[model samples]
Target: MTSLPEDSPPQMSEDDRDTAVQRLQEAYAEGLISHEEFDERLHQVLTAEARSELVSALASLPEKHPGTTSTIGAAGGRIQRHGVWRVPRFLKVESAFGRVRLDLSRAIIEHPVIDIELQLGTGRAEITVPRDAVVDVEGLRTGWKDLRYNAPRRSGPGEPKIQISGTMGFGRLKIRHARR
Candidate 1:
């Protein structure tokens, strides 16, 4: 079998693409990229239909911040993340027969974006963000789960975005914005 051409598109997972986009945002936030460059790169990243395109778009970006996976599990108890705390890149939060609250109003977001894999059962997951923070929820394949209120969020460069995904069983996930 002949190998694909050098210009051929590579295989990039959604997570990877998303991470690349986040890096671009971080670069823009750090003043490394001007608004024009940031807008152009972001458009390329978002409109890229192939993995090679994405790789090309990210080639000019700086090295991304190392991401760490953290787990916050609860059972018959309450888990809360509030005040000024360091938010990791990826968080695996599990709540079974308990409640979970993650408040990012005053949290220190080290990365441009954070991904939370929320697993809930017979419990509730409440995520509160500042009025300017952006919240995105996706990839929930829950049966009999009660997911209420997904408010639309529009994020920009230098803004914090939280991408929450996972499964919930007979539980509830509430994402609300704090009142000023």
Candidate 2:
């Protein structure tokens, strides 16, 4: 494999380089960068060709997302919710500065066959479900603290079980599921 040039951006510190790469990947996945832009910038970073390009890309990313300022409820913080509860799929909730609390206390249960999945990252996450909701959780990984679960006993015959798998860093995770 070819190597980076000697004068490429002073050889960024390992930690700084890793953080930049992670941010770039997250921005690409969140649609902040187009496929072509992502590919070109990733190539530049990997080959150490245009370090300034990476900086420019990172600077331009936040401008595209336009942070919102709405409060979710008694949560007393900014909570942005996306996706609908229709089918079994993935739900990703992320934050950098504040905690994320998912209060499913008011969710309407029309069908007794719904499955919920969650992915938490970089912040505290609290998920609350009702006593009769059937949930299967997966990929639950946390950092800085152990994952905690709290919920009332299940009212129905079937227990709401959680199948967790994933990793969290520098934060705590609390999953509240009703037990049968």
Give the residue spans of candidate 2 off by over 4 A. Answer: 1-77, 80-89, 110-119, 134-138, 151-155, 158-165, 177-180
- Tens digits of per-residue lDDT for model 2, 94-131: 45546676655554434333333334445676666655
Per-residue error (Å), model 1, residue 173: 0.7
TM-scores for all candidates?
A: 0.60, 0.40
Candidate 1, 52-164: lDDT as tens digits: 77777767665644557789887779999999998887889887778889988888888776778888887778888766777777656565866676575554566777777
lDDT of 1: 0.75
Task: Give the Å error, residue 110, model 1.
Answer: 1.3
Candidate 2: count of backbone clashes, pairs at least 3 residues apart or interchain: 7
Worst 10 residues of 1 by lDDT: 1-10
Most lDDT-accurate candidate: 1
Alpha-carbon deviation at 171 in model 1, angstroms: 1.2
C-alpha positional error of residue 89 in candidate 2 after TM-score superposition, expressed in Å? 4.8
